[model samples]
Target: MVPILDYLLQRQISPQWRGLLTALAEEFETQIGQGELRQLMYRVGCRFAAAAPLPPCSSTADLADALNACWQETEWGYVELSDEPEYLRIAHSCAPLLGFGAAALSWTPAFLEGVYQTWLSALGAEGLSVVQASEFDEHATIEFRLGRHPV
Candidate 1:
């Protein structure tokens, strides 16, 4: 496990803050709807990617290293990228989205989708799209696929 993540996992969140976050998540969903909230979060993620741009990577390994470094710094999860016949498969794990409460989990993964999409686009994958392909699993991992959108 990453040292920062290990420390974070060891720390406990206060119940008051947890309840507040839960209420805020429920309010956001109630006011904006899940889809719109996801879009908003996606934009927020785009901004994050822009703020902490990755250096140019000449290969997939380099890209992975760069991404891991960024994730380590941000304490966001780590990712595993695999080349597939049709698309690039991204398995991201250990994200702290659960800190926002269960309600937020339904939409917060879109933020990661946006972050990856923007980062890959900046890396010259102009026509590829990054989309969440699975929900958070037991390990707080989510799957994303990067490929051209179907017609």
Candidate 2:
């Protein structure tokens, strides 16, 4: 059962969208720069979160479940949330952003940052911020941290 589920989760993005995202990444990077492209993608993510707000959740597990439902519905991948003394650690795996091509990687994770920031803020995590903590690992997973706003 776990193997089958892993297979499903590892499904690749469709070639059509992959090509389009790759091209768009190139164009955006060439025209507006990677920083600007990241900001744009972040806004796109914020809009996505706005369109699909999660249900009220009282516990970390419940919140993870709600977030997983959203990810599964969109085939965007799933996240594991861990409670830490200082912040929430978010490990997101199998995101379709990889399909945007290697060049897109430098900025695409910002999209997830934006998505999580909005969602967490909506959950009453005011005064906190979500930021990428690490780059994509070999398994295409990325790490994010949600904590008090940086000085």
Candidate 3:
């Protein structure tokens, strides 16, 4: 998704066309209920993990390093992780979600949350849960807490 959007941006595509595409995507997603969308995202995440299981992250530092490496590989965003005693905090500069209209912005977070939830599940981090608390412009802030699983 980010790759395609970035490609369009790199080619200097018209903003109107981008907006139109974004709008259409948002509309399409709306037709799918939250439960179904999340199920699909979970499956996608599982598939991603099955494709290539990277080195296991056994500690917060390792998790941070792994996430940053994944972000670099994907070019989806810049990710920063803080391993606090109470929670794992993540701040992301999601480049693809930038410059789009507000309507398009709403769905990306939920999709991302689903992805994170499933990815973590696939990684066998059953005790950790992803909570998307805030989004401002292109930046998104999420928190992960131990012992609280996402249902």
Clash pairs of candidate 1? none
**Tens digits of lDDT, candidate 1, 61-120:** 888899999998877769998889989999998887776776688898988998999899
* Candidate number of the best lDDT: 2
> What TM-score do all the candidates reach, one by one?
0.87, 0.91, 0.63
Reference-based lDDT, each prediction: 0.84, 0.86, 0.57
Report residue 29 deviation for candidate 2 (angstroms).
0.8
Model 2 lDDT per residue over 1-151, tens place: 2554445533667766867878878888889987888898899889989999989999999999999999999888899999999999999988877677777889999999999999999999999999899998767689999998567
Whole-model lDDT, model 1: 0.84
Cand. 1 TM to true fold: 0.87
A best-first ranking of the candidates according to their lDDT comes to 2, 1, 3
Query: Candidate 1: where is the Cα deviation over 4 Å?
Result: 1-19
Off by over 4 Å in 3: 1-20, 29-52, 99-101, 138-151
Decreasing TM-score order of the candidates? 2, 1, 3
